[model samples]
Target: DRYFPSSKLCSSCGSIKKDLKLKDRIYKCSCGLNINRDYNASINLSRYELAI
Candidate 1:
């Protein structure tokens, strides 16, 4: 989905980081989730479910 926030969304806590920039290579969540941005996005993509 075009609106799916794969990179900006925290995979651990499901919170969206609206200010995330392309330069940000690490995904840090307020819930203490610290991971690589690409890895985090991949994890989120793997768990994505289409809302049909």
Candidate 2:
């Protein structure tokens, strides 16, 4: 029962980009964090369990 929007969410500031698309390979955050999309998603997914 996991429904988190890990890819669209910023791993640094927790801000979400509603217009993010799958073709984007990089995740850029306004908080000066720019990282690979997969890495960002992985980090965000790891935080999901702790969020509960």
Candidate 3:
């Protein structure tokens, strides 16, 4: 989905970081999910389901 905020979404809590920048390599969520941005994106992508 083109609207999926993979990089900005927290894998653990499903929270979206609206202020996330490309320079921000670390993905930090208020739910205490601290992980690499790319790694987090991968996790989110893996769980993505396409709606037909």
**CA-only RMSD, every prediction:** 1.7, 1.3, 1.7
Q: Candidate 1: where is the Cα deviation over 4 Å?
A: 49-52
lDDT of each model, Cα atoms only? Answer: 0.92, 0.89, 0.92
Query: Candidate order by TM-score, highest to lowest?
Result: 3, 1, 2
Worst 10 residues of 3 by lDDT: 43-52
TM-score of each: 0.88, 0.85, 0.89
Clashes of 1: 0
lDDT of candidate 2 vs native? 0.89
Q: What tens-digit string does per-residue lDDT give for candidate 1 at 1-52?
A: 8789999999998999999999999998999999999999988888886433
Model 3, TM vs. native: 0.89
- Tens-place lDDT digits, model 2, residues 1-52: 3668899889999999888899999998889889999999899998897877
Which candidate number has the best TM-score? Answer: 3
* lDDT by residue (tens digit), candidate 3, 1-51: 799999999989998999999999999899998999999999888888643
Segments of candidate 2 deviating more than 4 angstroms = none
